[model samples]
Target chain A: MASLIFQIVVDSLLLGGVYTLMAVGLSLAFGVTRIINFAHGDIVMYGAYAAFFAFVSLNIDPLLSLLFVAILGAIGGYLLFKLTLDRILDAPGINQVLLTFGLGLVLQNVAVILWTGDERSTTPSYAFDSWFLSDDIVVAKGRLIAFGLAVAFVVLLLAWLRWSELGRATRAVSQNRAAASLMGINVRAMYALSFGLSSSFGTATGAIMSFLLPITPFMGFPILVKAFAIIILGGLDSIVGTVIGAFLLATAETTIAYVVPQGIGWAEGVAFFLLVIVLIVRPTGILGTVGRDA
Target chain B: MNLSRTSVMVALSVFAAVISPAPSRAEDTIKIGAPLSLSGKFVSYGAAAKRGVEMAVDIYGGKVGNKKIEILFRDTQSDPQVAVNSFTQLLSEEKVNFLIGPIATPMAMAGLPAWRRTRALWVVPGATTPLLEEEAGKEPMLFHTFPYGYYYHLALARSLREKLGPGKTVAIIYSDDAYGREHLPYAQKYFTQEGFKIVAEELVRAGATDLNPVLAKIRRVKPDLLLGLVQTTDGIQLTKQVYVQRLNIPYLVGTAYPQLKQWQDASGEAQEGWVGVTTYIPGLKAKADPKYPKLFMDSDVWKAEFTKRYNREPEFIDVGAYVSTCMLLIAIENAGAVDDKEKVAEELKKLDVHTMIGRGHFEPSLGGTLNQAFADVVVHQRVKGADAILYPKEFETADKFEQATYAK
Candidate 1:
């Protein structure tokens, strides 16, 4: 029983890494642009496909092709910002939401046309290989790798946000858009950069995940739903809160699944459950200030 | 370039000619309506079924008797309402008295009213809910090309008893939806009768991504066998988690795992020794006459053509669609009339034709439920990245089922 508990804990942490990677970019984009960027998950889908194609066609390993995926993702993100977001930055929220939602549908359909609705995966030699830490405890190598990369990327992003000039400008814009413009922070450029960086993060997460999970055109929606839950649990603008929220949600789900009878199916519902609790208990979120107005 | 009254009249005549309908040849055309889920969750199966039907048409020289055969395809998008709407349009607007598919059970059930109203001969290739047999009693036009889900579990239970002896404990993890709900009771009844102890039964929501929690619960019971009646993606997810969590069951059985390349890719090294009940096995030696492959019923010609066109191997669902379409065409030819729906329906009921899967016919004793096709359901096991028939000694590709080993 002790060993099973230990294993679940370890597994939950690794799973949390994946959720953190998925949600952080969503939080970032929402913080800076306040547009929600509904197509964020589709960008991740494209990244996974990019990594898969590189592995199959170029014989480049999935890990090696992450750089290529990030570059392509950035370019795609830039184009999206220029084409759609640029036109509707100051438009009604409904219009912004609909445009992003429509973009997601378009990307999903285009992916279906190119790759079909078949579920695909990249099986590196070590995908199923695992390490036995003890007699009953094991860790999957692919998931471990993904977990490590997720943490490393998160740290790098935090550092960039703390120290870089563009990062400070982005934070300023996110905090107060009109004031940032008065301070001559190139608010438009920050918006574009935030979108590009957010997409790159999302794509990198997908690339890492391709080695761990199955890929399909329709795989994006579920991940997107979970991301929404995470951002709401964390403050929508708080990076630290996003990471904490992911781990908390993962732990709750894993524990519930282990403790409750026939609970595995209900694990997915944990996200929405957390969203509801958070909304009722603290509408501003775990990290949001009481007086900060949007 | 000046326009005179004569030139204007001539130009007007050409415009009218371009826009007008050609002389009606509806009498010389046999229209077959196919309502398939072409753009949603079931698109993979729908697309493959479409390809199979097309190949069957091509093999028939695209005609039946003196009339050219025309297939009108409508997309259901995996929605039951859309399926009913499509079927209604096909019957009422398109005037197609012959129909195939709505390959999912819910869609098939929803479209039953349209089938009854139109009295169209509806031959289903993939939907396998046992409720279909019950509903067929009320709707004479409905026919099932595929066997019910109970038949699959029955074959699987028989194979398990033969291979593992008896008294082994079995746990069933099934999706809580139409396919799994209809089939689980049958699996329980058959497995229990076969002397296996029912250790655990679990229902998972459709499209659930994780199974670790359920696996954790099952680990406490430690059954000898795990039976998963889930979709293709869920099956792959379950196998992967089983390996990761080191569940260590002696055997794993499921549907849709025997023939999909995507299954192999998703499950990776964990796929070995996973058994599934399947109707068609690729690379099975064809019983075709070498001289006239196209004319022979058991020919690999259709398989080759399907591969060449789709750039991949076909699954049983594809062959099911192909065989069903071929049966319909032969019935049309045998009836000697393209538009006689009753005659064609009678010919179908009397069919004893051979197909790529095997001989095709319905049991007339079942009355309105005479639509269920009798086909072989063989147990296939994954061995070294390829599926090998392992049960019912006659079709054994390998001598016997091997124990699965996991990477440490």
Candidate 2:
């Protein structure tokens, strides 16, 4: 019984790692640009396919292909912002939402046309390999690797935000756009950089996920919903809150799934349910400060 | 005044000529309307059905008797309303006397009213809901080539009883939509009657990616067999997760497992010994029958051509589409006239023909419904990266069912 509980906890933590990776970028985009970036998951889809093609056509290893995918994602995100978001920066909230939603539809349709609706997956040699801690407890190699990378990326990003010039400028713009503009920070450039960096995070997450999950043009919408739920639960602009929200959501889902009879169907609803509860109890989220820019 | 009168006379004469009946040509073509879900969630099946119909047309030399077959295709978008609208348009606007497909069960069900209203000879290729067959009882024009979902489960249940003996416990994990919801009860009914204990039954949302929660629950129960009445995506996901999480059950079986390439790509090496119930088994070496060798050879040639054209192995939906279309052509030929709808329906009722999948005949024993085609349901197991028939003693190509092992 103890072993079973331990297994569930380990599984939840691993799942939390994936959710953190998927949500952090979404949180960052919303934090800096306030665009919501509805197509963030589609960008992940593009990254996954890019990594897929690289592996299949170019015979590049998936890990090495992450670099190429991240670069592509950064460029694509920058161009997308310039083409779509730049024009509507000062538009109403509804307009921003609609624009991003429309862009997501376009990206999804284009992916379908290019790749067809067939589900694709990549299986490296160690995809299914695991390390056994005991007779009943095991750690999957793919999840462990993905978790390590996600943490590394998050730490690096936080460090950059603290120390790097561009990152600090981005934070300043996110905190107070008018003051940052008056203070000689390139607000537009910061917006573009934040969007690009956020997108690269999403793409890198997809590259890691490609080793674990099946890839399809339609796969993004579900993940997108979960990412939104996580950001909302964690606070829209708090990075630490987003990470906490991910683990909380994962734990709730896994635990509820374990307790209820035939509860798998309800497991997916746990995230949204948490979102509602979080909103009702604390509108500012766990770590959020009231009246902040984001 | 005389010139004006002459011009008026000429204009009146031209008007009269335009209003007159046109002369009939030497040969008239038969227009078959196909309302397919060619561009939505069901697009893969829709595309396969389209290819199948086209291939069947090619095989028939694009004609039946003295009439050249002309197919007018409409996309249903996997929407039932779209299916009905397309069917209505095909009947009223295109003036087609025959029809094929809507690809999915809900679309097929929704299009049934159109079938009754139009009374066009409708041959459904892919939808397998038994409810459609029940609803089809009132319409003589409606027919389905694919066996109902319940039939597949019943066959699997019988095979399980015979091959593995009785009293085994089974757990079912199915999608929570029309296809899975409707079939789950039937599976439970049949499996229970065959002496298998119903340990657990679970439903998951369609297109769900996270199945670990459900897998964990099932692992605790430790049923003898896991019956997955899920979509291709869900089935692949379940199998992969089952292997990765080491959820040990004696057997894991479901639909769409015969799609070897898809299963391999999705599940990797975990696909070995994965069993699936299917009507069409690609590359199955059949017993010698004087009438079937040519048909078998032709099917092989068609498969090769299909692979060459599509750059992928043909799915059972593709074969169902092809067979349904071929049956329609044969009925048209047997009717002796392209425009004779009543004669064509009569001919379809009398159809007892062999095609790519197997011998297809509408048995009258099934509630006197002459629309349901009876075909052999073979149990196929993934053996060494390819699916091999393993049940019904007669169709057993592999000597025995090998036990599946996962990495420890």
Candidate 3:
């Protein structure tokens, strides 16, 4: 029983790593823009599809194609932000939400139109090849690699946000756009950068996911939901809260899954249960008190 | 000439056109409505069936037995209400004498009642519910060019029971909708008779993701086998969670209708040794029936023509719709009239149509009075990156049927 609990923790941590990668991108976009990008999940899905196309068409390895996918995603984010998001920056919350929601639908439909809504997954050589720690427990090599990359990306992102001039500018705009403008920060460029960086994060997650799972055009919807749950649990404005929230949800969900009779359904239900608990107990969420924006 | 007299003359002319025996242009053209999902989840299936129909049309030079066939495509969006609306447009507005389907089972079921009022000849390829046959019994025009869900799912149960002895625990995660509900009764009936314990039965909302919760339930059950009777997206997500959770159950099976390349890519190595049952496999029994395989596989007819016309590899659902359309052609030609829906439906019941899958013979059975076509299915398992037929002994080209032994 102790060993089983240990196993669940290990599994949840690894799974949480992937969740962290997926959730952080949404958090960054929402943190800076104060607009919930419903298109974030589909953006990740598009990244995976772009990588899958490259992998299938050119035989390029999925891992190696991350740079290309990220760049493409960044460019797409820039163009979409310029055309749609830039206009709605100061709009009401509901309008901003509707804009991104409609944009997500368009992106999903565009993928369907082009690829016919067919399921596509990268046929990576090492996808299922995993090392067994013991006779009963095995860890997939692809996921482990993905976890390493996710950690490294998160570390690099934190360093940039803390140390780099661009990161400081982004943080300033997110913290106080009017004040940042008075202090000579190009708030417009900062919003673009934040959105672009978030896209890069989304692309990275997609690149990892496509090699691990079959990606369809509609895959974005669930991922979008999870990101929302994580952002809410982590405190929408808190980056550190996002990371903590991802782990909390992953661990609780995974642990409950094993203990509960109907684990899978229970786990999914628990996300909302957690949301309610957080709202009632500590409305600001775990680690959300420091600099939470409305 | 007074205005009232002119109006009366125009009304008379319109009435005469409706009552006229002659077709608009030539005695040749036969119009069939194909209400299929051109968007959403079932798009690939719809697209593939469309390709198969296009091929059939070209091979017959767009004519069957002195009549030129015109296929009108209507998108269903994989929604039941949308399908009903599409069928209404096809039947009442466009006035197609014959109808092909919306691919998914529920959409087909919902759209079925519309056909009753119009009394049009409707042939469905991908929607494979036994309930359809029952529904058709009340209104006999509904014809299916697909296998019943019970028959196909039974093959999976039989294979599993024989391959893995008795007393084993089986976990199932299925969609809590019509598609899953249709097959679950039959699965439960057979699996229980076979002496396997259903340890866990989890239901997922249609189009829901985050299969981790469901996976957690299955893992807790500690079943020897995990079975998924889910749609493509949920199936894919479940398979990933299984692999990620490292649940090493002996047999992991999925409902493998409308074979998508997504399963193989998504499940990857985890999909290895995964057992599934499907109705159509291009060249599986080609050696025994060389002509059947030759017509479906070796001929670049569909590939060349589809690429030339639509620029894509025809999906399985598209092929289904295409076959349904071709069957409509055979019926209309045999009936020898463009306007008679009942007569066309009667002719369709009598006709034996050969499709990409195999020979289809519609015979009146348990489901209804008019014979609904059923596809002969083979139990297939993935072995070393390729799908190999395992059951019925006749189609076994693989080395052996290896039973999955539980590891403690």
Candidate 4:
């Protein structure tokens, strides 16, 4: 029983790392842009496909190709921002959501058209290779590498937000675009830059994930939902909240999914159940203040 | 000016050449629409099915009975709404007379009404839930390429009950939603009738990645044999979790598309000794000629061809898809026309086609008079270094499967 519990913890934490990365990217974009990019998952999916193509054609290792994936994501997000986000700056929230939703559909279809709609998985040399901590518990090298990268990216992002002028401008634009512009911040450039950065992180996550698990175009929907839940749970505007939300939700889901005695199907329902309880008990989330709009 | 005009003419001709292939279907060409899940959860089904369809069409020189046979493919994305929309677009817009699939059951079910309204023949290559046939009823235009879901579960139940005896407790873990609901009644009925005690039955959702919670519950029940009809992702996760948890039993069986290669690749030796009841083999080596069914074991062409083509041995699902397209082509040939829905429907009911699986024939038995007669269910296991077929002594390629040690 103890060993089983331990194994469950390891599995949940590893799975949680992917969720955290996805949620953090969504939270970052939502915080700064105040336009929830419903297509964030699609962006991640595009990165995954990009990485897959790179792996297949160029024979590049998926892990090492994260930089290339990030670049592609930046280009994609920049183009999407220029093409769609610029037009929707003053549109209704519902319209913004629809626009992104349409973009998601378009991206998914494009992938299907180009990639032939096949479920692709990177046969990373490290995918099957694992390091054993003990007899009962083991960490897959791909996932272990992904976890480290996720934590490192989150830290680096936090540092940038705290220390960088661009990050400060982004935060200002997120809090109040008019005020940021009045204060001489390049609000337009900031919005596009923030979106680009968010997409870059999202792509990196997908590339890392491709190494850890299978990458299919359909996986975007589930990841999108999880990220939405995490951002909401962590308080949409709070970076600290996003981080906390990612860890908390990942831990809660992983633990309950492992220990709840029903199976992982029960784990899916756990997110919604947790969402309800968190909303009722602490609407601002674990890290959000009373005034925070989660 | 002359050079520029000549260049313009060349570009126009090139563009025309590229664009004109769309309308060039030969008078004898058979056009079939396949709205399979090219993207989304069941993408592999579409991918593998497309591969088989392409292979079949290639072998047939992309024609049937001197007519060029063309498959109009659409991506359903595995959502019923998407499938319905695709079907609407395909039927109302593209005017395809014959339909091949929406691989999953629910999508197939939703698309059926549209096909029924149009009076078009639906010879689906995949999606075998009983609800499809149950609802189709007297609609003779519907034919299933895969065996009924109930037939598969029944095969598992009967084989296990007969081999292991009725006294052993049977436990099943299935999907919680409509897919699972469709099979519950039939599974319960068969288990009771077969005299095996239903020790425990659990439901798991489609999108779940962890099975530790359910596995915990299942372990608490501690039944002799375990059966699962789970989604591919859940199945892969569960199989790995079971190994990590070191839960061992006499038998563990799974239904649905469990990527055996992925599972084994992830879990290694732990994934050994697992058994599944499937309609096709991703890597089964069978002779080209059905006359010497036994010769599949010795056919280097079968092994070499499958390996060279697929980069892995063919799973039963691959064969299932291959056989499905075979049936579709046979119907096309028999009808002598693809655009005549009525004739295509008529031809389908009279089909007696030879496939990689076995000899299959459809009769006027169910929806659209397409009663399928292929009843043999083969049990496959990953034994040692290869996938060994264990059912029907004549087709037996390896000795009986033995258990591998749990990998924890």
Highest-scoring model, lDDT? 1
When 2 and 3 are scored with lDDT, the better candidate is 2
Weakest ten-residue segment in model 4 chain B by summed lDDT: B291-300
The lDDT of each candidate is 0.80, 0.78, 0.73, 0.71
- The candidate maximizing TM-score is 1
lDDT of 2 by residue, A140-225 (tens): 78788877887888898899998999888988887888999999998888888889988898888788777677788877887798
- The native-contact fraction of candidate 4 is 0.30
Off by over 4 Å in 3: A133-136, A281-284, A287-294, B1-29, B64-67, B129-137, B159-178, B194-226, B237-252, B257-259, B286-319, B353-356, B364-370, B403-408
lDDT of 2 at A87: 88
Q: Write the per-residue lDDT of candidate 4 for residues B274-327, one digit (tens) a residue.
A: 777666554444445554232222334545565678786765555566666766
> For candidate 4, what is the DockQ?
0.26
Cα deviation of B107 in candidate 1 (Å)?
A: 3.0
Which residue ranges in model 1 land beyond 4 Å of their true spot?
A289-294, B5-9, B15-24, B286-296, B364-368
**Order of quality (DockQ):** 1, 2, 3, 4
What docking grade does candidate 4 earn? Answer: acceptable
Each candidate: RMSD: 2.6, 4.8, 6.0, 5.7
Candidate 4 local lDDT, A171-193, one digit each (tens): 78877888999999988888899
Which rank order by TM-score, best down to worst? 1, 2, 3, 4
Task: Give per-residue CA lDDT, model 3, range B38-89, as digits (tens).
Answer: 7887777776766766676775567766666788888888878888899889
- As for lDDT, the candidate ahead, 2 or 4, is 2
Task: Please list the residue runs of candidate 2 whose C-alpha ends up more than 4 Å from where it truly belongs after superposition.
Answer: A134-136, A288-294, B1-27, B113-116, B286-297, B364-369
